[model samples]
Target: MAEIKTSVTINATQEKVWDVISDIDNEPKFWKGTKEVRNISKNGNQISREITIAFRDQKCLQDVTIVPKETIKAVFTEGVIVGEKILTLKDMENSCELEALWDVKLSGKMGMFTGIIKKHIKSGTEQALQAIKEEVEN
Candidate 1:
């Protein structure tokens, strides 16, 4: 699997950070890899959606679950890639730590390119984290 993990220390409370991340519709604003989002359904904190990814503008189906101020887990169910991406938040004395973990790999014949894509994914994740930090702090 192509796994990428990254984190950012935001100068804001968990609640503040949660407010920013939980706005799933605004994901494309911070995550460049995610070009667009279309919600399919919603039940409480769980949502089913299709997200357009930057890679060939591929659309992936995802089942996302939000755990209040703790975590956001998105499981990719279909498309060119499959696996999960999780966002976790840890409260600190004066700020909060936001961590993003991606465990995904290209499907079918494209699997061979997983290693090559890892670098792009890692860089995108780091950039996304930095964007989030700037959004929250300023």
Candidate 2:
């Protein structure tokens, strides 16, 4: 398992930041590689979506666990990869600090290239955080 942690400080209220981060529908706007989000199924607090990532012509279940205004954790509950994404928001009075912690653990042949996988994921995390910061601050 490879852990990747990234964070950005946005000049926005915690609630405002939370409003944007908690909405799965808002992801496509900020996530560059996320092409589309569809087939949303909500089971009480757990929510899952079939997402089209990039131009792969494929989709996977992105199961989410939310903690109201505090955190949003997502994982590939079923798909080619296995990992967890935990996004947390800290109220910094004047500004909010948003952090993302990602863990990737794949099986079979893909598992051998954990270093390459983690590098790509870390880049994505940085990009996503920067996008979120720009969206919230602007």
Candidate 3:
């Protein structure tokens, strides 16, 4: 598994940040790479959803698992490659920090090209964290 982790601190209270992060539907608004997210099923904090992520001209379908105020994990159940993303939030003295950790295992033709694509995924996750920071700070 290849892992990428990125974090950013927001000058907002944990609760304030959580309010935005916890709402899975609002992801596209903050994460530019995400084109859309539709909830497939939900039972309290546990949720299953389909996410459409647009990178350049490619739109990929991902199966996502969300645990409110805690973790959000998404995997490419179908698409060019198989991969997973994990986002977590933590409180830190008058501010909140959001961390994005991604572990991806490429399969099929994509697996043969995983080395070239890994950097893009890492950079994208970093950009997503930056967007989240800006949203929470502003």
lDDT of each: 0.94, 0.82, 0.74
Q: Over all chains combined, what TM-score does candidate 1 have?
A: 0.98
**Which residue pairs collide in model 3, if any?**
none
Model 2 C-alpha lDDT per residue in residues 47-100, reported as the tens digit of each score: 888887663444667888899989898897765557888999999979989999
Q: After aligning candidate 3 to the native by TM-score, how far in Å is the CA of 60 from where it should be? A: 5.0
Off-target runs (Cα >4 Å) in candidate 3 are 55-63
lDDT of 3 by residue, 1-138 (tens): 577788888889877777887777888877766788877777665566666766444445566677767778777776665778888888889887889887875667657777776787777777777777787788
Instruction: Report residue 31 deviation for candidate 3 (angstroms).
Output: 2.6
* lDDT (10s digit) by residue, model 1, range 60-101: 999999999999999999998889999999999999999999
Q: How close to the true structure is residue 131 of candidate 2, measured as C-alpha lDDT?
A: 90
Largest TM-score belongs to which candidate? 1
Candidate 3 structure lDDT:
0.74
lDDT for 93 (candidate 2): 75
